[model samples]
Target chain A: MEDALLQAFLFAQETAEEDEGSLIDVVPGLMVWTFVTFLIVFWVLRRFAFGRIQGLIDQRRDRIREALDEADKARSEARELRDRIAQERQQAKMEREQILEDSRRQAQRQLEQGRERADADLRERLEKNREELDAENARLREQIRRDVVELTLLASEKVTGKVLDEDDQRRLIEETIEEVDVKRLASEN
Target chain B: MSPLLAAAESDFDPQHEFLLEEWIPLHLGPLDLSVNKAVVYIWLGGIATILLGIWLMRFGLSLRPDRRQTTGEAVYDLVQSQIAESSIPTKALHIWFPYVASLFLFIWVLNIIGFVPLPISNDTFDLFGVELPTLGIYAATANLSVTLALALITFFATHVEGIRYNGPTRYFKSWIPEGAPKPLLGLIVPLEVISQFMRLISLSVRLFANMLAGHMLILVMLGLIFIFSAWWLVPFSIGFGTVIYLFEVGIVVTIQAFVFALLSGIYIGGAIEPEH
Candidate 1:
């Protein structure tokens, strides 16, 4: 069988040499060479080239993904910080308004209290002036009454035109006084 | 005659240019262990890919990536999202990510190497009695055997993952849809088997045809310069060749690598689930 195969190979080789560019010709030697070459190439590339290159590519992809995730996290953190700052600013504005409102209310109460105290002082001064004026008017009336009695007594003396004893003078004055008191009592009735 | 003029005088054959010359000849009992130009380029391309990968890995996980690190990350991102995550099931992405990514890098490096001018001797004619006809550069993926082997790997991986995920019996049972009539299954089962095999052919041919066609078109365009031997044809031929070469390098190389990896992922993912 081996000898037959050898004869066949030799025959094919001879024919291939004669008929160049024959499509159906099978050159067993060349076939073996090509297969061996292909096998060596495939094995070497698989072991060394493909495996290492793939690992590097995968690692690069993983790094890019991690970087993207980190960027997203940073973006969210910045948004949160802005939101908190805005909230703080709003709170501060509200507190300022609250303090202003409290001060205004305090000023209003002070103004009202001052006005009330001034009014009460004016009222007390007016009452005191009216009471003093009444006392002065009552004293002035008693003085006018004493002057009238003196004038009436002088007129009685001028009408009699004579020297009078002490008992007589006293009787005259008492009579005059009783006549004045009778006239004032008739008017009051 | 100068070697260049001698090489230019020779007939330009695309097949002859692409054919591999044995570099190191060895043999086992039934195996031919001769290393060829394509095999050498494959080794060089593989080593270049490994060195670049090691250089990028040295950057580790830098916070500020330099140009090399950035490029490394970009490649990883493309494979992870475009191929693995998009095509494979979520649960199976981790397990299959390396295979899909490695496939993309390996194929891409191999495809792009065609643009770099590495001189290989054509065995067709003795130019000025020197035996070496002309020098040419060829992409390894342009060869059908290489593409076929790659497709076979995907094919085996798909079924292996299917069995691993769904168990042996369940994986086989998944060929026929659930709730299908027994009579319909008779038709469906064979079609399913054929379609699975078709994946192998389609995947292989798709890559093989695209690479081979692109390289051949450039070679043919450049050969026009030699065929005409007119100074006037140089501008057009060389210009068009350059344009096509740039297009292949920029567009074809990237799309082919991406398609192969994506299809492999889809096939494996489909096998695992089998519903869609």
Candidate 2:
């Protein structure tokens, strides 16, 4: 095999020499060498470089996808939180309105009760004043009658220049009072 | 002769510089296990890619990625969205991601390495007592063998993926469009097979020709100054070469890498779900 290779090489060298480098001749040996070298390169690159790179790229892609998913999750959570807060605020607002309404109703009821109590108290005071006024008028009228009777007695004594006994005077005054009463009744009728 | 003149004269040999050199020679049982500059540069590109992968992996894939991790993720994302996800079915992206990503990165690094100037002192090295240029590095993609090998891999992988997706018998049957008349089968089948083979050739040649042409243009432009050996041509050559170099490195490298990956994805996708 070695002898044959040597002979072939010798023959190629002779031809190469004769041809004087035509630039078209194909060298079988160079082709074989390039093939071997390239194959080795391809193998190395495939096994070590490309293999790892592909894995890494895939991993990076997955990580990015996961990150996007997490971001979506976070955004949803934030939206939920906002919704809950809004609901709570609405509840508080409604509660506040209810409390205010209740207080207003209570105040109105108390005002009405106070007004009713004041009205009752004012009516009672007015009735008591009327009774007092009637009593005072009756007392004044009785006193005036007594004074008139005394004056009539004094005038009679002056005219006669004498004084009457108690029984006689009483009878005379009674007669005069009866006559006055009759006249007053007729006039009223 | 002045060293500068001698150096310039030596530097202008694109044939010597672009051709494969056996930097290290070995044999393994009817196989010539020799290392050429293209292979060496390829090794460098591979090492650089491996180191970058290791550095990125050190970040350990985080949710909050750092700057380095972001950059790494961007590359992976580009491959995943632009190549794997766009090309294959959703279910199949997982299976095809690594292969597609590896191809893109490998080719990308390999294309970009052409811009890196290696330190080779013309003062020291000689080939058969003949003076040579200070540098002899070339992009592996510029080589026919390297591009052919990569395209071959794509071709086989596409067919295999097709078979895996559609059963062996159905896979071949899918080549024929549905609802086509029976008489057209005779013409279409051969054309389809031819086109399939043509894909492989075109894929290989496109990358090879683009890289090769860019490097050759730069080499030829730079070589003009040396070939003319005139002081006046120096600025023109250097200016033009710099502009071309920048254009190649900036635009060509990125476009080629993208196109290669895009085509591979499209091809694999078509095979998986044939138009018919």
Candidate 3:
């Protein structure tokens, strides 16, 4: 029985003698080797792969922030442009109203001057007509006096063959008209 | 001779009673890699976890998460908060969570596999020319390969986190903290460098030792049931086996998984926060 147990122990350790050898040679020290390998691999991976990925992530974050800032700037600029356009439109509208008001005032002034000139022309025509009527009335009165004097002289010539003076003609005309009216009335009675 | 050595050998090998070779070939390939049965079960458990995780993620996701998704999310958050963020930075933690969670769940499922009943017996099967041992991959934690793979992953993650936290020059300096009294650094630096390399072995061995010891104990206990001829001995041994099996289901699997995850966290934490 001791031999069998011894045999088992030998079997466990035998592969170490082979030239190509099994891992058993290092088996006793396996723990030490494993520990060392693990640490070295851990260190190498940490330095190369992990560090690079982290940098990439940080860079991506910064890019996103910059994009957001650009978007904000664009929005603000658009709003400012809209406000400026609104201000310009309002100023233009006010200027248009001022021009319209000025045009109305100019037309009103021209109309007033045209009306004043027509009124002056009407007043001058009325004064000239009044003078022409006065003149015509004096000429008709003279013609009537000349015809009455001539008629009185022709009547005198036919009756007594004599002509009257100018002053006497005037005074005789007034007296004959009054004497005629009294004689006509006495004959009718 | 020691009494213990005598008892260890004379004992009619419980493993020998069953004609393991008559039923199946022990050596599998040119390397004569003995297919550890538990190793196969470990692979099955890992595959099951991956398939289930994918199915749940694919069909169960909702804008307003359903109950399944809610449960998954809760567990995920728990792992993230308790294990991941505590060790790694919040910035880098999300990137590492998937790999960490995969390792955790994979080991967990593998460890618990022994408790789960297999539809097919592990008994040897007839092959093309000869009988072949049951081909199965046990909980990877039970085998050296799976544990080594996990350690390698941890090893890679640590370095990655270290680099992210500190550039190469600063990272190497982290092996020895800032204020070690310049003269003492020469002595301490070699020790620090040696310890740094030891982390991989430590990581693998911790899980491997716990899992290997537990499986060997269970195997011995179950193998004992087959050794005795008395009918009464069968009942007693079976009862004890059942209890041990149940404990494995409840405690061993969870504890081993936690240990692996905890160690991973520690390794990553040390790398990122060298100040600690």
Candidate number achieving the greatest DockQ relative to the actual structure: 2
Q: Write the per-residue lDDT of candidate 2 for residues A46-71, one digit (tens) a residue.
A: 88888888789989889999999999
Which candidate number has the best lDDT? 1
Q: Least accurate stretch of 10 residues (summed lDDT) in model 2 chain B? A: B116-125
Query: Any residue pairs clashing in model 1, and if so which?
Result: none
Encode model 1's per-residue lDDT on B1-276: one tens digit a residue: 446544775855555656676778877778876888777877887887777766775445586688889998888889889999888999998788888888888889889886777655545456677665345667888777888888899999999999999998999899877898987888999998999999998898777767777777787688876766655777898899899899899999999999999999999998888876
Candidate 3 lDDT score at position A84: 90
Please state the error at residue B180 of candidate 3 in Å.
2.3
Which run of 10 residues does model 1 chain B get worst, by summed lDDT?
B118-127
Sorted on lDDT, best first, the list reads: 1, 2, 3
- Chain B TM, per prediction: 0.89, 0.89, 0.75
Error of 1 at A122 (Å): 5.0
Give one digit per residue, the lDDT tens place, for model 2 in B1-276. 457877879755655556665768877878776876777877888888777876786446677888899989988898888887888776567767777787888888888887777743223467899767565446788777888888898899899989998888888888777887898899999998998999998888778777776776677678887787777887898898898789889998888887788788878887888752
DockQ-superior candidate, 1 or 3: 1
Give the winner by TM-score: 2
Better of 1 and 2 by TM-score: 2
- 1 or 3: which has the higher lDDT? 1
Q: Could you give the DockQ of candidate 3?
A: 0.01
lDDT of 3 by residue, B73-187 (tens): 5555555567776766566664665555555666676677755655323455677978765532134354444567667778887988888788877888888866789889889
